[model samples]
Target: MILIKYIIRNHIIPFLFACVVLISIFLLQFLMKFADKLIGKGLETIIIVKLIVYNLAWMVVLVVPMAVLVATLMAFGNMSQNNEIAIMKASGISLYKMIIPPLISSILIAILLVYFNNKIYPDANHAARLLMEDITRKKPTLSLVPGVFSQDVSSYAILARDVIQESNELKDVTIYDYSNPPKVNIVTAKEGKIFLVPNQKKLIMDLKVGEIHESDIYRQNVYRRLRFTHHKIAMPADQFTFEQSTPGGPRGDREMGAAQMLAIVDSINKVQSSYQKEFNSKIDQIIDKKFNYKPIDTTSNKYIYVKVEQRLRMLENGFTDVLNRIEYNRKEINRYMVEVHKKYALPVACIVFVLIGAPLGTMTRKGGIGMASGISLVFFVIYWAFLIGGEKLADRDLISPFVGIWSANVFLGIVGILLLIKTAKEKVTLNFEFITKRIPKSWKSSDDEIENN
Candidate 1:
């Protein structure tokens, strides 16, 4: 009973502390990439706070496993280092007995983590993405300086002779639309007001006393064009923000909506089928001899044959590549499908991480927290590597999601078994330097070569 209290006191608290630290570091890391997006956007403090908070959910979800891993390692490592683990074993207590308290704690943490990830994190992530998309469209107006050319969004160009900062109003504004022909539609406004769309998805430039110009450059090749201008021209609104599609949408591995992913799959398949049909027709031409490959002029025939063959090969390869992409996307979709079954699968993973962590901590008798940490990190690395490899394979249409997401777990389970066997015999389960030495000479790159890459 005393030992159980000791285990709870020493192990669980440190693990949670470590989780918080890991989350902080992850937020810092996630935010650094988008420094430019946040800066110079003239966003309100509340909006900025909301954006940052929302973004943190993704970072937190990603960091949970790592936090659990490090914390377990550190807690167990401390136990071994302080001789607590040894004392437990010496008192006729088995290694398995020592693991129970920590395992129980880890399971609780996992449950809490899952609740946060599935519920709060999803809502926050969706909100953040939408907020950022709105800021993207809103950037153009914010970047508009009184006397400078500001290219905030890539699609449109706006030139304002003067601007008012207080109301975000523009004076003598000229806007250019380069989307399609009539390639240059120009708008000049005596004054303009930037208003957000009703759903806050788009930015509307409400031009007061504005003239719209349309260019006529192509009239069946009498292209020496004419241009016309209009009074009171209103620009179309920007695209909607990143709202979660209706619930029934297809989702893929990245946890996209199911309906959305299925729709994409259909689109991709259509493209693949189109390419396949085009390739088949070329093959038919060769087999049926409807067009002679034999050219009376040897040069023209050779040119045609070479071009045709190259085109056919390209189309054939493209078709196969598309099929592969579909296969890979299917794997990703499967991973996302796991989300639908999260209540079952995730609880099991939480249980599994504890099992793996306990055995791992016990096997390396020395180096306490240090060894536990190293071991945890190594296993996690292997786990992450398998996940990445599986995703790549799926992307190449070589594997499925069932194989990809679970491959890391499968490999960990094998290692867990091996370690368990060694621990049962009171033998070391791992040698820190063993894997390094086992790497083949041919595969090892020099430090300089690694740096060059």
Candidate 2:
């Protein structure tokens, strides 16, 4: 019991460390990729934070399994390096028994992850999507440059000969208002100050020594001009306001839970079954018609041939329609099934990684983050490649969703079991010195420096 406790305890710090590092990396990447969309939008701090937090759900899902792999490698490799494995073997404790605690723990983690994926991940994805849409719909703060026409506002354009950035002042401003149809309104001011309302719902421009020119489009001869010492124009600024919408709407496959997706897939399958039956019946009818043809003595040969051709054409069109519907349903089923399997498949990877990590860790006998990360990176790359490629193939109806999503786990699980069995019976060591030798001296020196730090 003490030994098992100690083994499990060793994994805690490494797993947490791996999770933090991976999540930070993912968060940084997310920020960098979306910086353009978020910057200069004048969004509240909370909105941006909410977006990051919502997106973290998916990052957590991806990071947890990889963290399992890294933690396993580090824990076992440290034990092996310290000769603890040798001591245990001398006392008759097999590697298999030492693995039991971690394996069981991995199963529990997998279960929690499954629940999280089905319950929490979907809503987070949906909320993130809606929030992003709202953010994109929001226009950036109003900007006007000197000697340029600014049309950032709807149905209005303002040209300024000189703009004072510090004072929010414009000189020799010319405004064109197109909010009303069949009427042309132009305002020119000697100087003006422009500012937005506190709620950001309206833009107000105060002009001094300006003239308003109004003319009707249909009546060219009718024109009115008025001179004023001071005037104010209020324009709608709703688009510039950052309004958060409630997250409620139609969701895509990635935004639905496995149970919901499975229900959809089942419904689609029933529809496809109906289509298949209808297609079969149509084929039977066509066959009957083809075999039951009888020549009429009163009908000319040309008319008979034309009738047969028309019937054949109708049958062809019907068959094509039924076949197309079935094909479409099949594709839909594949898409939803892929998502359903994905919900479980990725969570199941925690267990699979444990199987692979334990045996490989013992063989490598290295516990440093650099070594474990490098090894984990290679395996994870291969795993993700299989997963991504499988999803694409499954979506195209080239393969079953089961095969597409679970192939990585199966392949790695088998390899892990084989390695575990072989290592249990004997000893094996993996030589990674050749890989290190290929690294440039500068890179190796930098790695060494980081390790020292």
Using TM-score, give the best candidate's number.
2
Candidate 1: where are CA atoms >4 Å away?
A: 141-215, 218-335, 338-347, 363-373, 395-397, 427-453
Candidate 1's displacement at residue 266, Å, is: 16
Residue ranges of candidate 2 with Cα displaced over 4 Å: 140-241, 290-299, 439-453
Instruction: List TM-score per model, in order.
Output: 0.60, 0.80
Best by lDDT: 2
Model 1: per-residue Cα lDDT over 1-453, one tens digit each: 998897677666656776677777777776787766666556678877888888877666656666666666666656765777778777888767776886777678677866775567556656766677666554445467777765553456778888665576788887777767555677777777775556655567777776666665665443332233323333344442323233333322344433444556566567656656665665665566454345567746677787668766765676567556655645444544444333223344555666676666655544344555567667667766776777566555566655656667667767666665666458354456777688767566774477589
Give the per-residue Cα lDDT of candidate 2 at 153: 80
Lowest lDDT sum, 10 consecutive residues, model 2, at: 136-145
How good is model 2 by TM-score?
A: 0.80
Per-residue error for 453 in candidate 1, Å, reads: 42
Candidate 2 positional error at 366, Å: 0.5
In the range 21-119, model 2's lDDT, one tens digit per residue, is 999999999999998788766679999999999999999999999999999999999999998988998899999999999999999999999999999
